[model samples]
Target: MLEIRGLHAWYGDSHVLHGLAMDIPRGRVVSLLGRNGAGKSATMRTIMGLLGKATGEINCNGVNLLKLRPDQIARKGIALCPEDRGIFPSLTVTENLFLPPVVAAGGMDIASIYALFPNIRERGASRGTQLSGGEQQMLAIARILRTGARLLLLDEPTEGLAPVIVQQIARVIREIKELGYTVLLVEQKAHFVESLADIHYLIENGTIVDRLESAEFAASRDRVERLLAV
Candidate 1:
């Protein structure tokens, strides 16, 4: 569903991605794993057209996303839940979720999103700032869901959540996969990826260093740990 080839991105004069290439198959969850500053988030930003300068081919479902604006890329069925969750602190949960529906094709109904995230449903009236980290994460995902986007670019969705909430998020990811959505997951949590992802791509210094199937990834624990350790 998503193809990135020879991708390079820079923030001002600082180069962050260098010839990174990877493909995410339709309806599969592909995890991008790396330690801090290894360009995982940079790749995500470039894919979402958030970077100021980028060079490469980013094709999503047959369209070239590199030539499009961020909103245009999003309109092509990609929704990003950024590393920081990007919740609007002033808006209530429902409002924050409904805000992105204006730009999307098939708008997601509140009930379905509420069903996917019961916690957010329970705190439907709470402002973004009033939520816990996990709640904020849920809000972020739910907000993306409301956009009716089929491909999700999730950057560190489990970053600061409690273990229980992380598990819940993992389950939700699995559910989304079952529902036929493609997910490009950037995460530091290897264990969670072990159970959720179909394939793994290890990136370092802005390039893809290794690509492994889930079974191969499971068997290379030591290598995975070495690459991810700071």
Candidate 2:
């Protein structure tokens, strides 16, 4: 549902993304995969309009995302769950989770969220600062799902968490996809992305240098792995 071409992004004088290109069709999971210094996070930030300057085209469905403000971008059914932050620190989990009122027509209700991720409900009383990283990540996903956004730009959802929590996050991602949500994921974990991604883009230095379908990736992970070996 999103299309990007020749994308260029900058952080003031520092040019981070160079002619990056990506295409995300509806109801599928796509990933941007690379080493730590690659521009995966920068690409996501540019799409969400969080950066001060970026160029080229970012179209969600038929709308040109470049023309819209950040809040307007969200209202148009896109959500960015960043690597470092996702929730309002001052609010309780319950408040941060449901504060954004439903905008479009397909959001999950409170009961539905509790159903999909009971972890969130169990920690409802905890402040955003009090929840663990995994809980905050889940809360971030829940908050976006509550907004009726069909496309999720999830950046490193499994980073820094324990393996069990990573598995839990994976399960949640699969469930969300099953429920008809599309995802644009940024991650360094090749195996993790391999499990859930339909297509994968290998980014380097500021642009996508290669791409692999899941089968190709599975059969040839070693090649990609070596490229990311640092």
Candidate 3:
């Protein structure tokens, strides 16, 4: 559902991505794995049109994403749950949940999102800043669901959560897949990706160094370890 070709992005004069290319098919989960500063986040930013200087094509569902503004790209059915969870600290949970509906098509109903995340339902009236790290992450995901985006660009969704919460988040992702959404995920936790990803790409120094199917990825533990070990 998404294709990036020969993508090059720079922060001022400091170039990051160099001729990076990849494709994500409809209804599949693809993981972008790399160490810190490997340009995984930068790739996500570029795709979302958040970067100041980027050259290349980001096509989603046969439309050119690079030509559009960030809000326009989002309106075309791509939602990003960033690494920091990007929650509005002062907004109540219910308010945050309702925020994305303004930009989303068919709008995610409260009941459906509640069913997907019961924890959020329990904390519906609490302010964003009052939630725990895991709760904040859940809120982030729930917010995106409200958008009803067909393609989800999730960056480090499990970054700082506890094991149980991470597992819960993984289950939610599986549920999202069952609901027929395509996901492009950037994750630092290798094991998390192992269980959830259909395909994997090893990104280093702003480029994709290796791409493998899920089975092949699982069998090559040493290769994954060597590439990501810091």
TM-score of 1: 0.96
- Worst 10-residue lDDT window, candidate 2: 97-106
State the displacement of the C-alpha of residue 138, model 1, in Å, after optimal TM-score superposition. 0.5
Q: At residue 191, what lDDT does model 2 achieve?
A: 90
Question: Clashing residue pairs, candidate 2?
Answer: 1-25
In the order shown, the candidates' Cα RMSDs to the true structure are 1.1, 1.3, 1.1
Question: What lDDT does each candidate get?
Answer: 0.89, 0.88, 0.89
Cα displacement (angstroms), candidate 3, residue 42, comes to 0.7
- Which digits, one per residue and each the tens of the lDDT, describe model 1 over residues 16-98? 99999999999999999999999998998888899999998987767878899998987788888998888899999878877
Ranked by TM-score, the better of candidates 2 and 3 is 3
lDDT for model 1, please: 0.89
Per-residue alpha-carbon lDDT of model 3 for 1-230, expressed as tens digits?
Answer: 88889999998899999999999999999999999999999999988899999998888777878888999988887888999898999999989887766575765678888899999989999999899998999899888878868888899999878999999989999999998888998987789999899999999999999999998987886898788999
Best-to-worst ranking by lDDT? 3, 1, 2
Flag regions of model 2 displaced more than 4 Å: none
Ranking by TM-score: 3, 1, 2
How high is the lDDT of residue 60 in model 2? 84
Q: How do all models score by TM-score?
A: 0.96, 0.95, 0.97
For candidate 3, which ten residues in a row score worst on lDDT? 99-108
